[model samples]
Target: MAETRSTTAPRVVRREPTLTGELLAEFAGTAILILFGVGVVAQVVAGQNGDDDSIHWAWGLGVTFGVYVAGRTSGAHLNPAVTVALAVFKGFAWRKVLPYSVAQLLGAFVAALIVRWVYADAIATVDPRTTFDSQGIFSTLPGAGVSIGTAFLDQVVGTALLVFLIFAVTELRATPPAANLAPFIIGLIVVAIGFAWGSNAGYAINPARDLGPRLASFLTGYSTAMREPGGQFYFWVPIVAPLIGGVLGGGLYRVLVERHLPDQTDAEQPTGRIPAEDD
Candidate 1:
């Protein structure tokens, strides 16, 4: 019998991702995120528009900066679902993935809490005669006769579209756009969803962007309109739907493009928030 040996290259030792440190980075990033979303509510409610379209513009710009800054450092996920999706696709580590998600959600919740304190008075003015359903503040509403299923469909469909768009731009684009402009591009994506589908679902694309504030609003004791007439039972769509859509989108990228990437598991050299720049 002849002895045969196989030749394979050894895996390289890379620097650890520093999950704890990433949490700190994510927390700071999420603070800015909530500040924008919650701040917009306060601004709009407090009449900061001042005869101009201040609220939407302010939020758009705010989100752009936050994503850019955090993305430059911590990958700017800020949302658990996004993190989870990336991890599932192996863009991030499985070991730190769960902790990262926990940190992201906690960060958003804490940010929401602070925003509640900051925007207390403004939220208080949303008519004490009505309950303040925080989720609806960022989305559209269903009429009295609309079924619960219909409302859920709105969230599901809107979130699916959002995840699909994000995947298209981030993964499948033939050419990666300018690094500095990626966040701006993401902001524009949200804006488009908000405008196109917003009329139906208010387009709650990001889960952290919604659940964080909703929990904070309830905990802060400023809401009077918590239970609207739209059968507000299916709030999970915003959280779950996007994740589902993101996975599908990532799979689409892998099948259509990543398979052809120089290194399917890791192609682009991540620039901290950017994907690995080292091949």
Candidate 2:
């Protein structure tokens, strides 16, 4: 008699999406943004291979790709400023703000560490002393002859433009780009800010974008990472200014643009402020 043999296939289990998954998306998205943004700066400063335009384009593309990566999960708020703005105006759940910001910060920090690791030889060769100039590659710094007040104002304006444009393009009532095209347009907005506002304080415009890598540089022996060459405490400018700017921009868009637009009909109503997270 032939022996009976039975084989059971393994059961596959799928877990439902949760806040943790969203947070991981935020983390990875921000890390991707920093990886390209900082990598270009490193190439320019340490490797001596590129120029300002190269840095701008790389950072823009970084944002574009980062959004594409995390847009489906967390709406791709790769910047703390963006996260705060959404929480303030878009009903993004205030409880998630701190978590999202922390995830972004950690992502930037880890990406900066990785950038340093990858370009260790080049960075060491070019910036052996870890001076303020070298530190700028990791984080933003005031440009020559830029006052602290001017830097603050510059960040405010830059980030305001960022969040305002974000609202403009994402608002269902406004003339928004196609869903597939919004990320590229957002990236272009960053590039435009870099071109116009970068000279004052490197156009940080994003708190996590500045502070996370700044902390990394501090740990990696950049003594002036948290301060200016003149010994002024400069870190707060990027952080505080962007937060203020984000709210201002979002509010401005709501007041000046969104309110003026015709309300959506029932069939065309927007489900959420950001379409990416609606799913």
Best-matching candidate per TM-score: 2
| lDDT (Cα, tens digit) per residue for candidate 2, span 48-101 | 999999999999999999998888788999998998898888878888889999
- Over 37-86, each residue of candidate 1 has an lDDT whose tens digit, in order, gives 66676656543443224444555566677777677456777766667667
User: TM-score for all predictions?
Assistant: 0.74, 0.91
Off by over 4 Å in 1: 1-17, 46-56, 133-135, 138-147, 171-173, 222-228, 256-279
Q: How far is candidate 1 from the true structure (C-alpha RMSD, Å)?
A: 9.2
Clashes of each: 17, 0
Looking at model 1, residue 233 earns an lDDT score of: 46
Q: Residue 195's C-alpha lDDT in candidate 2? A: 89
lDDT of 1 at 101: 65
Determine which window of 10 residues in candidate 1 has minimal summed lDDT: 270-279
Local distance difference test, candidate 1: 0.59
